[model samples]
Target: MLGMSTTTGHGHGHTHDGINWAERLGHLQAIDALDRDTHADVAQRLAAGLPEGATVVDIGSGAGGMSSAFGRALAAAGGGTVVLVDAVPALLDAATAHVRAEAPAVEVVSVLADAADPALPELVPAGDLVWASGVVHHLPDQQRGVNTLARMVRPGGRLALREGGLATQCLPWDVGIGTPGLQGRLLAARESWFERMRADMPDVVRLPGGWGRALAAAGLGDVTSLGFLVDHPAPASAPARESVVNWLTFMADMAGEWLSEEDRATVARLIDPHDSAFVGNSDDVFVLSASTVHHGTRPVPPA
Candidate 1:
Protein backbone atom coordinates (compact mmCIF):
# COMPACT_ATOMS: atom_id res chain seq x y z
CA MET A 1 0.00 0.00 0.00
CA LEU A 2 1.14 3.55 -0.73
CA GLY A 3 1.77 6.19 1.92
CA MET A 4 -0.73 9.05 1.89
CA SER A 5 -0.40 12.61 3.11
CA THR A 6 -3.28 14.02 5.08
CA THR A 7 -3.89 16.05 8.17
CA THR A 8 -5.13 13.85 10.94
CA GLY A 9 -5.27 13.89 14.69
CA HIS A 10 -3.98 10.34 14.55
CA GLY A 11 -0.90 9.81 16.74
CA HIS A 12 0.96 8.28 13.80
CA GLY A 13 1.81 11.77 12.49
CA HIS A 14 1.82 13.19 8.96
CA THR A 15 3.66 15.46 6.50
CA HIS A 16 2.72 17.45 3.45
CA ASP A 17 2.94 15.07 0.48
CA GLY A 18 5.27 12.74 2.38
CA ILE A 19 5.45 10.62 5.50
CA ASN A 20 6.77 12.21 8.64
CA TRP A 21 9.96 10.17 8.64
CA ALA A 22 11.13 11.03 12.16
CA GLU A 23 7.84 10.07 13.75
CA ARG A 24 6.53 7.32 11.47
CA LEU A 25 9.75 5.51 10.64
CA GLY A 26 8.55 2.24 12.16
CA HIS A 27 5.34 2.26 10.15
CA LEU A 28 7.20 3.03 6.93
CA GLN A 29 9.84 0.37 7.64
CA ALA A 30 7.21 -2.27 8.29
CA ILE A 31 5.46 -1.48 5.00
CA ASP A 32 8.79 -1.71 3.16
CA ALA A 33 9.48 -5.10 4.70
CA LEU A 34 6.05 -6.37 3.71
CA ASP A 35 6.40 -5.16 0.12
CA ARG A 36 10.08 -6.07 -0.39
CA ASP A 37 9.57 -9.23 -2.44
CA THR A 38 6.92 -7.75 -4.72
CA HIS A 39 9.14 -4.73 -5.27
CA ALA A 40 12.09 -6.94 -6.23
CA ASP A 41 9.92 -8.70 -8.78
CA VAL A 42 8.91 -5.39 -10.35
CA ALA A 43 12.58 -4.37 -10.45
CA GLN A 44 13.59 -7.56 -12.23
CA ARG A 45 10.99 -7.05 -14.95
CA LEU A 46 11.85 -3.36 -15.42
CA ALA A 47 15.58 -3.90 -15.43
CA ALA A 48 15.44 -6.51 -18.18
CA GLY A 49 17.15 -5.81 -21.51
CA LEU A 50 18.86 -2.68 -20.23
CA PRO A 51 22.39 -1.86 -21.26
CA GLU A 52 25.28 -2.93 -19.03
CA GLY A 53 25.43 0.38 -17.17
CA ALA A 54 21.88 1.66 -17.18
CA THR A 55 20.82 4.50 -14.95
CA VAL A 56 17.58 4.03 -12.94
CA VAL A 57 15.84 6.75 -10.98
CA ASP A 58 13.34 6.10 -8.20
CA ILE A 59 11.21 9.14 -7.52
CA GLY A 60 9.69 9.69 -4.08
CA SER A 61 11.79 6.74 -2.91
CA GLY A 62 10.74 5.96 0.67
CA ALA A 63 12.98 4.01 3.00
CA GLY A 64 14.83 2.94 -0.17
CA GLY A 65 13.19 -0.48 -0.33
CA MET A 66 12.20 -0.17 -3.99
CA SER A 67 15.34 1.73 -4.86
CA SER A 68 17.52 -0.99 -3.34
CA ALA A 69 15.50 -3.58 -5.20
CA PHE A 70 16.24 -1.69 -8.42
CA GLY A 71 19.90 -1.48 -7.44
CA ARG A 72 20.08 -5.26 -7.00
CA ALA A 73 18.45 -5.77 -10.37
CA LEU A 74 20.85 -3.33 -11.98
CA ALA A 75 23.77 -5.11 -10.36
CA ALA A 76 22.56 -8.36 -11.84
CA ALA A 77 22.43 -6.66 -15.26
CA GLY A 78 26.19 -6.04 -14.93
CA GLY A 79 26.27 -2.66 -13.09
CA GLY A 80 24.47 0.69 -13.03
CA THR A 81 23.35 3.63 -10.92
CA VAL A 82 20.15 3.95 -8.88
CA VAL A 83 19.23 7.47 -7.94
CA LEU A 84 16.85 7.96 -5.00
CA VAL A 85 14.82 11.15 -4.93
CA ASP A 86 12.50 12.39 -2.19
CA ALA A 87 11.52 15.59 -0.45
CA VAL A 88 12.30 14.32 3.01
CA PRO A 89 15.97 14.45 3.94
CA ALA A 90 15.75 11.61 6.44
CA LEU A 91 14.06 9.35 3.91
CA LEU A 92 16.66 10.24 1.31
CA ASP A 93 19.47 9.42 3.76
CA ALA A 94 17.80 6.17 4.79
CA ALA A 95 17.22 5.16 1.16
CA THR A 96 20.84 6.01 0.26
CA ALA A 97 22.17 3.82 3.07
CA HIS A 98 19.74 1.03 2.30
CA VAL A 99 20.63 0.94 -1.42
CA ARG A 100 24.36 0.92 -0.64
CA ALA A 101 23.98 -1.85 1.90
CA GLU A 102 21.58 -3.97 -0.12
CA ALA A 103 23.17 -3.52 -3.55
CA PRO A 104 26.81 -2.76 -2.94
CA ALA A 105 27.76 -3.52 -6.55
CA VAL A 106 25.62 -0.68 -7.88
CA GLU A 107 26.24 3.04 -7.50
CA VAL A 108 23.72 4.96 -5.38
CA VAL A 109 22.82 8.65 -5.29
CA SER A 110 20.22 10.58 -3.26
CA VAL A 111 18.57 13.89 -4.04
CA LEU A 112 16.42 15.74 -1.51
CA ALA A 113 13.90 17.55 -3.64
CA ASP A 114 10.17 17.62 -4.07
CA ALA A 115 8.78 15.74 -7.05
CA ALA A 116 6.70 18.77 -8.00
CA ASP A 117 9.73 21.01 -8.30
CA PRO A 118 9.90 22.40 -11.83
CA ALA A 119 13.68 22.34 -11.82
CA LEU A 120 13.95 18.64 -10.88
CA PRO A 121 15.45 17.73 -14.24
CA GLU A 122 18.36 20.08 -13.57
CA LEU A 123 19.23 18.22 -10.36
CA VAL A 124 18.93 14.63 -11.57
CA PRO A 125 20.42 13.30 -14.74
CA ALA A 126 18.39 11.50 -17.41
CA GLY A 127 17.69 7.89 -16.57
CA ASP A 128 17.51 4.68 -18.57
CA LEU A 129 14.42 3.92 -16.48
CA VAL A 130 12.45 6.33 -14.30
CA TRP A 131 10.29 4.71 -11.64
CA ALA A 132 7.69 6.45 -9.47
CA SER A 133 5.51 4.29 -7.28
CA GLY A 134 2.57 5.80 -5.37
CA VAL A 135 4.00 9.23 -6.00
CA VAL A 136 2.12 11.33 -8.58
CA HIS A 137 -1.07 11.46 -6.52
CA HIS A 138 0.75 13.46 -3.89
CA LEU A 139 1.56 16.34 -6.19
CA PRO A 140 -0.76 19.31 -6.48
CA ASP A 141 -0.56 19.03 -10.25
CA GLN A 142 -0.20 15.37 -11.19
CA GLN A 143 0.22 15.74 -14.95
CA ARG A 144 2.92 18.36 -14.45
CA GLY A 145 4.72 15.93 -12.19
CA VAL A 146 4.41 13.19 -14.81
CA ASN A 147 5.70 15.57 -17.44
CA THR A 148 8.67 16.40 -15.20
CA LEU A 149 9.45 12.71 -14.77
CA ALA A 150 9.06 12.10 -18.49
CA ARG A 151 11.69 14.73 -19.10
CA MET A 152 14.16 12.71 -17.04
CA VAL A 153 13.89 9.60 -19.21
CA ARG A 154 16.47 9.49 -21.97
CA PRO A 155 15.27 8.83 -25.49
CA GLY A 156 14.22 5.16 -25.80
CA GLY A 157 14.22 4.81 -22.01
CA ARG A 158 11.09 4.00 -20.02
CA LEU A 159 9.11 5.69 -17.26
CA ALA A 160 7.00 3.51 -14.99
CA LEU A 161 4.33 4.93 -12.66
CA ARG A 162 2.83 2.68 -10.03
CA GLU A 163 -0.56 4.04 -9.10
CA GLY A 164 -4.09 2.65 -8.80
CA GLY A 165 -5.14 -0.92 -8.20
CA LEU A 166 -7.32 -2.75 -5.74
CA ALA A 167 -6.70 -1.76 -2.15
CA THR A 168 -5.35 -4.39 0.23
CA GLN A 169 -7.90 -6.80 1.67
CA CYS A 170 -6.70 -8.59 4.78
CA LEU A 171 -9.72 -9.42 6.90
CA PRO A 172 -12.45 -11.69 5.60
CA TRP A 173 -15.83 -10.20 4.77
CA ASP A 174 -17.31 -11.85 7.80
CA VAL A 175 -14.81 -11.39 10.59
CA GLY A 176 -17.19 -12.73 13.30
CA ILE A 177 -16.47 -9.92 15.77
CA GLY A 178 -17.45 -7.08 13.52
CA THR A 179 -20.62 -6.79 11.41
CA PRO A 180 -20.73 -9.28 8.53
CA GLY A 181 -19.53 -6.65 6.07
CA LEU A 182 -17.11 -4.71 8.23
CA GLN A 183 -14.40 -4.80 5.60
CA GLY A 184 -16.74 -3.45 2.95
CA ARG A 185 -17.80 -0.57 5.15
CA LEU A 186 -14.22 0.17 5.98
CA LEU A 187 -13.30 0.28 2.29
CA ALA A 188 -16.15 2.67 1.63
CA ALA A 189 -15.06 4.97 4.41
CA ARG A 190 -11.52 4.86 3.15
CA GLU A 191 -12.61 5.86 -0.31
CA SER A 192 -14.54 8.79 1.06
CA TRP A 193 -11.58 9.83 3.17
CA PHE A 194 -9.27 9.59 0.18
CA GLU A 195 -11.54 11.85 -1.87
CA ARG A 196 -11.52 14.45 0.88
CA MET A 197 -7.77 14.20 1.25
CA ARG A 198 -7.18 14.89 -2.43
CA ALA A 199 -9.57 17.81 -2.42
CA ASP A 200 -7.79 19.30 0.59
CA MET A 201 -4.39 19.21 -1.07
CA PRO A 202 -3.05 22.65 -1.91
CA ASP A 203 -3.65 23.61 -5.50
CA VAL A 204 -4.92 20.14 -6.35
CA VAL A 205 -5.73 19.57 -10.02
CA ARG A 206 -8.06 16.91 -11.26
CA LEU A 207 -6.42 14.17 -13.35
CA PRO A 208 -8.80 13.32 -16.15
CA GLY A 209 -8.59 10.05 -18.16
CA GLY A 210 -6.45 8.42 -15.48
CA TRP A 211 -2.71 7.59 -15.57
CA GLY A 212 -2.51 5.80 -18.94
CA ARG A 213 -3.78 8.85 -20.79
CA ALA A 214 -1.61 11.03 -18.57
CA LEU A 215 1.44 9.09 -19.78
CA ALA A 216 0.38 9.42 -23.40
CA ALA A 217 -0.26 13.13 -22.96
CA ALA A 218 3.27 13.48 -21.62
CA GLY A 219 4.60 12.69 -25.10
CA LEU A 220 5.65 9.12 -24.27
CA GLY A 221 4.96 6.30 -26.71
CA ASP A 222 3.78 2.70 -26.43
CA VAL A 223 2.05 3.27 -23.12
CA THR A 224 1.27 0.14 -21.15
CA SER A 225 -0.42 -0.60 -17.82
CA LEU A 226 0.27 -3.68 -15.75
CA GLY A 227 -0.61 -4.86 -12.27
CA PHE A 228 1.49 -6.78 -9.74
CA LEU A 229 -0.13 -8.66 -6.92
CA VAL A 230 1.11 -9.15 -3.38
CA ASP A 231 -0.75 -12.08 -1.97
CA HIS A 232 -0.12 -13.77 1.39
CA PRO A 233 -2.67 -16.44 2.02
CA ALA A 234 -4.07 -17.52 5.39
CA PRO A 235 -1.51 -17.99 8.14
CA ALA A 236 0.32 -14.94 6.88
CA SER A 237 3.96 -14.30 7.73
CA ALA A 238 4.87 -12.32 10.85
CA PRO A 239 5.76 -9.26 8.79
CA ALA A 240 2.59 -9.49 6.71
CA ARG A 241 0.50 -9.83 9.85
CA GLU A 242 2.22 -6.84 11.38
CA SER A 243 1.75 -4.84 8.21
CA VAL A 244 -1.96 -5.65 8.23
CA VAL A 245 -2.22 -4.52 11.81
CA ASN A 246 -0.45 -1.27 10.99
CA TRP A 247 -2.67 -0.64 8.00
CA LEU A 248 -5.85 -1.27 9.99
CA THR A 249 -4.61 0.98 12.73
CA PHE A 250 -3.93 3.74 10.22
CA MET A 251 -7.34 3.45 8.60
CA ALA A 252 -9.05 3.30 11.96
CA ASP A 253 -7.25 6.43 13.01
CA MET A 254 -7.46 8.41 9.79
CA ALA A 255 -10.94 7.46 8.70
CA GLY A 256 -12.51 6.59 12.02
CA GLU A 257 -14.61 9.71 12.07
CA TRP A 258 -16.39 8.70 8.91
CA LEU A 259 -17.26 5.28 10.31
CA SER A 260 -20.18 4.47 12.54
CA GLU A 261 -19.49 4.14 16.26
CA GLU A 262 -20.04 0.40 16.11
CA ASP A 263 -17.71 0.00 13.15
CA ARG A 264 -15.08 2.13 14.82
CA ALA A 265 -15.22 0.03 17.97
CA THR A 266 -14.94 -3.12 15.92
CA VAL A 267 -11.85 -1.82 14.20
CA ALA A 268 -10.33 -0.84 17.52
CA ARG A 269 -10.79 -4.38 18.84
CA LEU A 270 -9.49 -5.90 15.61
CA ILE A 271 -6.19 -4.04 15.87
CA ASP A 272 -5.68 -4.59 19.58
CA PRO A 273 -3.10 -7.36 19.95
CA HIS A 274 -4.34 -8.43 23.34
CA ASP A 275 -7.93 -8.83 22.17
CA SER A 276 -9.00 -12.42 21.58
CA ALA A 277 -10.69 -11.30 18.34
CA PHE A 278 -7.66 -9.46 17.00
CA VAL A 279 -7.66 -9.89 13.22
CA GLY A 280 -3.93 -10.24 12.96
CA ASN A 281 -3.86 -13.22 15.28
CA SER A 282 -6.52 -15.11 13.34
CA ASP A 283 -5.47 -18.19 11.41
CA ASP A 284 -7.68 -17.03 8.54
CA VAL A 285 -6.11 -13.62 8.25
CA PHE A 286 -4.56 -13.05 4.83
CA VAL A 287 -2.97 -10.28 2.77
CA LEU A 288 -3.90 -9.37 -0.79
CA SER A 289 -2.96 -6.16 -2.64
CA ALA A 290 -2.55 -5.20 -6.28
CA SER A 291 -0.41 -2.35 -7.56
CA THR A 292 -0.75 -1.07 -11.12
CA VAL A 293 2.24 0.31 -12.95
CA HIS A 294 1.85 2.48 -16.04
CA HIS A 295 4.75 2.37 -18.46
CA GLY A 296 5.74 4.68 -21.28
CA THR A 297 8.84 5.05 -23.40
CA ARG A 298 10.50 8.20 -24.65
CA PRO A 299 10.42 7.29 -28.34
CA VAL A 300 13.74 7.07 -30.08
CA PRO A 301 13.97 9.41 -33.06
CA PRO A 302 13.36 7.85 -36.47
CA ALA A 303 16.45 7.19 -38.54
Candidate 2:
Protein backbone atom coordinates (compact mmCIF):
# COMPACT_ATOMS: atom_id res chain seq x y z
CA MET A 1 0.00 0.00 0.00
CA LEU A 2 2.86 2.26 0.35
CA GLY A 3 4.70 3.16 -2.79
CA MET A 4 6.18 0.21 -4.72
CA SER A 5 9.56 0.67 -3.00
CA THR A 6 8.00 0.27 0.43
CA THR A 7 8.82 -3.31 1.33
CA THR A 8 7.23 -4.94 4.40
CA GLY A 9 10.46 -5.97 6.14
CA HIS A 10 13.10 -7.05 3.62
CA GLY A 11 14.88 -3.76 3.21
CA HIS A 12 17.29 -3.55 0.29
CA GLY A 13 18.67 -0.09 1.28
CA HIS A 14 19.23 0.31 -2.42
CA THR A 15 19.08 4.00 -3.47
CA HIS A 16 16.51 2.87 -6.03
CA ASP A 17 14.44 1.45 -3.20
CA GLY A 18 11.99 4.13 -2.17
CA ILE A 19 8.75 5.74 -3.28
CA ASN A 20 8.62 7.53 -6.61
CA TRP A 21 5.48 9.69 -6.66
CA ALA A 22 5.79 10.46 -10.36
CA GLU A 23 5.98 6.83 -11.51
CA ARG A 24 3.06 5.78 -9.34
CA LEU A 25 0.99 8.52 -10.89
CA GLY A 26 2.04 7.39 -14.32
CA HIS A 27 0.93 3.87 -13.51
CA LEU A 28 -2.51 5.23 -12.72
CA GLN A 29 -2.45 7.21 -15.92
CA ALA A 30 -1.75 4.02 -17.76
CA ILE A 31 -4.76 2.55 -16.03
CA ASP A 32 -6.76 5.47 -17.36
CA ALA A 33 -5.51 4.78 -20.86
CA LEU A 34 -6.68 1.20 -20.73
CA ASP A 35 -8.19 -0.10 -23.94
CA ARG A 36 -10.63 -1.93 -21.77
CA ASP A 37 -12.39 -0.49 -18.75
CA THR A 38 -9.94 -2.08 -16.33
CA HIS A 39 -11.28 -0.97 -12.97
CA ALA A 40 -14.89 -0.55 -14.00
CA ASP A 41 -14.98 -4.00 -15.54
CA VAL A 42 -13.37 -5.60 -12.54
CA ALA A 43 -15.45 -3.54 -10.14
CA GLN A 44 -18.72 -4.46 -11.79
CA ARG A 45 -18.00 -8.12 -11.19
CA LEU A 46 -16.52 -7.60 -7.71
CA ALA A 47 -19.45 -5.47 -6.59
CA ALA A 48 -22.06 -7.89 -7.87
CA GLY A 49 -20.85 -10.46 -5.37
CA LEU A 50 -21.12 -8.04 -2.45
CA PRO A 51 -24.06 -7.18 -0.27
CA GLU A 52 -25.69 -3.79 -0.69
CA GLY A 53 -23.79 -2.38 2.29
CA ALA A 54 -20.70 -3.87 3.88
CA THR A 55 -17.40 -2.76 5.36
CA VAL A 56 -14.20 -3.82 3.57
CA VAL A 57 -10.52 -4.03 4.49
CA ASP A 58 -8.27 -3.35 1.53
CA ILE A 59 -4.83 -4.75 2.30
CA GLY A 60 -1.63 -3.48 0.69
CA SER A 61 -3.81 -0.79 -0.74
CA GLY A 62 -0.98 1.24 -2.25
CA ALA A 63 -1.96 4.88 -2.44
CA GLY A 64 -5.47 3.44 -2.56
CA GLY A 65 -5.08 2.61 -6.23
CA MET A 66 -7.46 -0.36 -6.29
CA SER A 67 -9.05 0.79 -3.05
CA SER A 68 -10.49 3.78 -4.84
CA ALA A 69 -12.04 1.42 -7.36
CA PHE A 70 -13.47 -0.81 -4.63
CA GLY A 71 -14.77 2.25 -2.79
CA ARG A 72 -16.45 3.55 -5.88
CA ALA A 73 -18.20 0.25 -6.44
CA LEU A 74 -19.45 0.04 -2.85
CA ALA A 75 -20.60 3.63 -3.04
CA ALA A 76 -22.62 2.86 -6.11
CA ALA A 77 -24.16 -0.15 -4.39
CA GLY A 78 -26.02 1.87 -1.73
CA GLY A 79 -22.82 2.89 0.12
CA GLY A 80 -20.35 1.18 2.43
CA THR A 81 -16.90 1.69 3.95
CA VAL A 82 -13.54 0.80 2.41
CA VAL A 83 -10.75 0.77 4.99
CA LEU A 84 -7.56 1.13 2.98
CA VAL A 85 -4.44 -0.03 4.86
CA ASP A 86 -0.87 0.30 3.65
CA ALA A 87 2.36 0.60 5.62
CA VAL A 88 3.52 3.44 3.40
CA PRO A 89 2.39 6.87 4.57
CA ALA A 90 2.81 8.63 1.26
CA LEU A 91 0.88 5.95 -0.60
CA LEU A 92 -1.94 6.30 1.89
CA ASP A 93 -1.91 10.02 1.26
CA ALA A 94 -2.18 9.58 -2.48
CA ALA A 95 -4.81 6.88 -2.15
CA THR A 96 -6.80 9.20 0.10
CA ALA A 97 -6.68 11.97 -2.46
CA HIS A 98 -7.53 9.62 -5.31
CA VAL A 99 -10.52 8.20 -3.46
CA ARG A 100 -11.88 11.63 -2.65
CA ALA A 101 -11.38 12.81 -6.20
CA GLU A 102 -12.67 9.61 -7.73
CA ALA A 103 -15.30 8.28 -5.29
CA PRO A 104 -16.30 11.10 -2.96
CA ALA A 105 -19.55 9.42 -2.05
CA VAL A 106 -17.86 6.31 -0.71
CA GLU A 107 -16.65 6.29 2.90
CA VAL A 108 -12.88 5.89 2.73
CA VAL A 109 -10.60 5.49 5.76
CA SER A 110 -6.86 5.26 5.18
CA VAL A 111 -4.88 3.39 7.84
CA LEU A 112 -1.11 3.09 8.00
CA ALA A 113 -0.16 -0.41 9.08
CA ASP A 114 1.27 -3.76 8.08
CA ALA A 115 -0.91 -6.66 6.92
CA ALA A 116 1.10 -9.26 8.86
CA ASP A 117 0.93 -7.39 12.17
CA PRO A 118 -1.24 -8.92 14.93
CA ALA A 119 -2.72 -5.50 15.58
CA LEU A 120 -4.47 -5.78 12.22
CA PRO A 121 -7.17 -8.13 13.54
CA GLU A 122 -8.25 -5.52 16.06
CA LEU A 123 -8.19 -2.77 13.45
CA VAL A 124 -10.37 -4.75 11.03
CA PRO A 125 -12.90 -6.92 12.78
CA ALA A 126 -14.19 -10.27 11.55
CA GLY A 127 -16.98 -10.28 8.90
CA ASP A 128 -15.74 -7.24 6.99
CA LEU A 129 -14.92 -8.29 3.44
CA VAL A 130 -11.17 -7.98 2.69
CA TRP A 131 -10.06 -6.67 -0.69
CA ALA A 132 -6.44 -6.60 -1.75
CA SER A 133 -4.47 -5.96 -4.97
CA GLY A 134 -0.84 -5.44 -5.88
CA VAL A 135 0.14 -5.86 -2.23
CA VAL A 136 1.24 -9.49 -2.07
CA HIS A 137 4.57 -9.34 -3.93
CA HIS A 138 6.10 -6.91 -1.46
CA LEU A 139 5.07 -8.91 1.56
CA PRO A 140 7.96 -10.86 3.09
CA ASP A 141 5.50 -13.06 4.96
CA GLN A 142 2.60 -14.23 2.80
CA GLN A 143 1.10 -17.04 4.87
CA ARG A 144 0.89 -14.96 8.01
CA GLY A 145 -0.81 -12.08 6.23
CA VAL A 146 -3.16 -14.39 4.33
CA ASN A 147 -4.14 -16.12 7.54
CA THR A 148 -4.76 -12.85 9.31
CA LEU A 149 -6.69 -11.47 6.36
CA ALA A 150 -8.96 -14.52 6.31
CA ARG A 151 -9.81 -14.06 9.98
CA MET A 152 -10.61 -10.39 9.53
CA VAL A 153 -13.45 -11.17 7.14
CA ARG A 154 -16.57 -11.74 9.22
CA PRO A 155 -19.16 -14.45 8.73
CA GLY A 156 -20.54 -14.61 5.19
CA GLY A 157 -17.96 -11.98 4.28
CA ARG A 158 -16.32 -12.16 0.87
CA LEU A 159 -12.60 -11.73 0.28
CA ALA A 160 -11.41 -10.70 -3.17
CA LEU A 161 -7.65 -10.51 -3.57
CA ARG A 162 -5.33 -9.86 -6.52
CA GLU A 163 -1.56 -9.48 -6.69
CA GLY A 164 1.14 -9.03 -9.31
CA GLY A 165 2.28 -12.53 -10.18
CA LEU A 166 4.30 -14.26 -12.89
CA ALA A 167 2.31 -16.91 -14.67
CA THR A 168 4.71 -16.72 -17.61
CA GLN A 169 7.99 -14.92 -17.98
CA CYS A 170 7.81 -11.89 -20.23
CA LEU A 171 9.66 -11.68 -23.52
CA PRO A 172 12.56 -9.30 -23.99
CA TRP A 173 10.26 -6.36 -24.73
CA ASP A 174 8.07 -6.90 -21.66
CA VAL A 175 10.93 -7.85 -19.36
CA GLY A 176 11.34 -4.55 -17.55
CA ILE A 177 10.41 -2.93 -14.25
CA GLY A 178 6.82 -2.33 -15.29
CA THR A 179 6.57 -5.96 -16.26
CA PRO A 180 7.85 -9.36 -15.17
CA GLY A 181 11.33 -7.99 -14.51
CA LEU A 182 9.95 -5.99 -11.58
CA GLN A 183 9.71 -9.25 -9.72
CA GLY A 184 13.23 -10.03 -10.89
CA ARG A 185 14.70 -7.10 -9.00
CA LEU A 186 12.71 -7.98 -5.91
CA LEU A 187 13.92 -11.57 -6.19
CA ALA A 188 17.50 -10.44 -6.76
CA ALA A 189 17.38 -8.06 -3.81
CA ARG A 190 15.40 -10.18 -1.39
CA GLU A 191 16.50 -13.67 -2.23
CA SER A 192 14.81 -14.96 0.87
CA TRP A 193 11.51 -13.29 -0.02
CA PHE A 194 11.09 -15.27 -3.21
CA GLU A 195 12.47 -18.48 -1.76
CA ARG A 196 10.01 -18.46 1.12
CA MET A 197 7.16 -17.37 -1.14
CA ARG A 198 7.87 -20.10 -3.67
CA ALA A 199 7.74 -22.65 -0.90
CA ASP A 200 4.35 -21.20 0.10
CA MET A 201 2.62 -18.67 -2.31
CA PRO A 202 0.58 -21.49 -4.07
CA ASP A 203 2.01 -22.59 -7.38
CA VAL A 204 1.99 -19.14 -8.93
CA VAL A 205 -1.71 -19.10 -8.34
CA ARG A 206 -2.18 -15.40 -8.89
CA LEU A 207 -5.39 -14.72 -7.09
CA PRO A 208 -7.69 -17.41 -5.93
CA GLY A 209 -5.79 -20.67 -5.50
CA GLY A 210 -3.02 -19.77 -3.11
CA TRP A 211 -5.27 -17.15 -1.61
CA GLY A 212 -8.07 -19.72 -1.46
CA ARG A 213 -5.85 -22.16 0.36
CA ALA A 214 -5.02 -19.52 2.92
CA LEU A 215 -8.70 -18.70 3.22
CA ALA A 216 -9.63 -22.33 3.77
CA ALA A 217 -6.87 -22.58 6.34
CA ALA A 218 -8.46 -19.59 8.06
CA GLY A 219 -11.87 -21.23 7.62
CA LEU A 220 -13.16 -19.62 4.41
CA GLY A 221 -15.27 -21.15 1.59
CA ASP A 222 -16.57 -20.55 -1.93
CA VAL A 223 -13.32 -19.61 -3.62
CA THR A 224 -12.53 -18.88 -7.32
CA SER A 225 -9.74 -17.35 -9.49
CA LEU A 226 -9.51 -15.56 -12.89
CA GLY A 227 -6.57 -14.36 -14.97
CA PHE A 228 -5.43 -12.78 -18.27
CA LEU A 229 -2.44 -10.85 -19.58
CA VAL A 230 -2.66 -7.45 -21.20
CA ASP A 231 0.12 -5.20 -22.32
CA HIS A 232 -0.27 -1.49 -21.55
CA PRO A 233 2.05 0.13 -24.02
CA ALA A 234 2.61 3.84 -23.56
CA PRO A 235 2.36 5.51 -26.92
CA ALA A 236 5.33 7.58 -27.99
CA SER A 237 3.14 10.64 -28.40
CA ALA A 238 1.38 10.34 -25.07
CA PRO A 239 1.11 13.58 -23.15
CA ALA A 240 2.88 12.29 -20.09
CA ARG A 241 5.77 10.62 -21.89
CA GLU A 242 8.18 11.67 -19.14
CA SER A 243 6.06 9.57 -16.81
CA VAL A 244 7.75 6.50 -18.28
CA VAL A 245 10.99 7.36 -16.49
CA ASN A 246 9.15 7.58 -13.20
CA TRP A 247 7.29 4.41 -14.07
CA LEU A 248 10.46 2.39 -14.45
CA THR A 249 12.11 3.89 -11.36
CA PHE A 250 11.32 1.08 -8.92
CA MET A 251 12.32 -1.59 -11.40
CA ALA A 252 15.54 0.34 -11.63
CA ASP A 253 15.73 0.58 -7.86
CA MET A 254 15.53 -3.17 -7.27
CA ALA A 255 18.21 -3.79 -9.87
CA GLY A 256 20.44 -0.99 -8.64
CA GLU A 257 22.78 -3.15 -6.61
CA TRP A 258 22.70 -5.98 -9.17
CA LEU A 259 22.73 -4.33 -12.58
CA SER A 260 25.57 -2.10 -13.74
CA GLU A 261 24.70 1.54 -14.28
CA GLU A 262 24.99 1.02 -18.03
CA ASP A 263 22.47 -1.85 -18.15
CA ARG A 264 20.24 -0.02 -15.74
CA ALA A 265 20.36 2.93 -18.10
CA THR A 266 19.34 0.55 -20.84
CA VAL A 267 16.33 -0.32 -18.77
CA ALA A 268 15.41 3.34 -18.72
CA ARG A 269 15.95 3.58 -22.45
CA LEU A 270 13.68 0.62 -23.18
CA ILE A 271 10.91 1.89 -20.95
CA ASP A 272 11.25 5.45 -22.28
CA PRO A 273 10.54 4.36 -25.84
CA HIS A 274 6.87 4.65 -24.82
CA ASP A 275 5.72 2.45 -27.70
CA SER A 276 7.50 -0.65 -26.47
CA ALA A 277 5.07 -3.52 -26.10
CA PHE A 278 5.20 -5.33 -22.78
CA VAL A 279 3.47 -8.41 -24.21
CA GLY A 280 6.31 -9.70 -26.28
CA ASN A 281 5.67 -11.69 -29.48
CA SER A 282 5.84 -15.11 -27.94
CA ASP A 283 3.66 -17.81 -26.37
CA ASP A 284 5.96 -18.32 -23.42
CA VAL A 285 4.44 -15.40 -21.47
CA PHE A 286 1.25 -14.32 -19.88
CA VAL A 287 0.43 -11.92 -17.04
CA LEU A 288 -1.43 -14.82 -15.58
CA SER A 289 -3.53 -14.19 -12.49
CA ALA A 290 -5.51 -16.55 -10.32
CA SER A 291 -7.80 -13.98 -8.81
CA THR A 292 -9.48 -15.69 -5.86
CA VAL A 293 -12.89 -14.57 -4.76
CA HIS A 294 -13.97 -16.43 -1.66
CA HIS A 295 -16.57 -16.24 1.12
CA GLY A 296 -16.22 -17.18 4.77
CA THR A 297 -18.53 -17.51 7.72
CA ARG A 298 -17.50 -17.09 11.32
CA PRO A 299 -17.09 -20.66 12.51
CA VAL A 300 -18.46 -19.74 15.87
CA PRO A 301 -21.70 -17.97 16.61
CA PRO A 302 -21.51 -14.27 17.59
CA ALA A 303 -20.46 -14.10 21.23
| Candidate 2 ranges with C-alpha deviation above 4 Å | 1-36, 125-127, 164-209, 233-247, 260-262, 271-303
Question: lDDT per residue, candidate 1, 1-303, as tens digits?
Answer: 011111111122234543355555677778888888888999999889787799999988888889989988987878888888877666776778888888888877777777888888888878999999888987888999999999999999999999999998988888887578887888899888878888888888999988999999999999998889999898888878888888888888768889999999988888899998887777888889898999999999889
Instruction: Compute each candidate's TM-score over C-alphas.
Output: 0.91, 0.65
Q: What is the lDDT of residue 303 in candidate 1?
A: 92
- For candidate 1, which ten residues in a row score worst on lDDT? 1-10
Clashing pairs in 1: none
What TM-score does structure 1 among the candidates reach?
0.91
Error of 1 at 183 (Å): 1.2
Each model's backbone clash number? 0, 11
User: RMSD to the native, candidate 2?
Assistant: 8.2
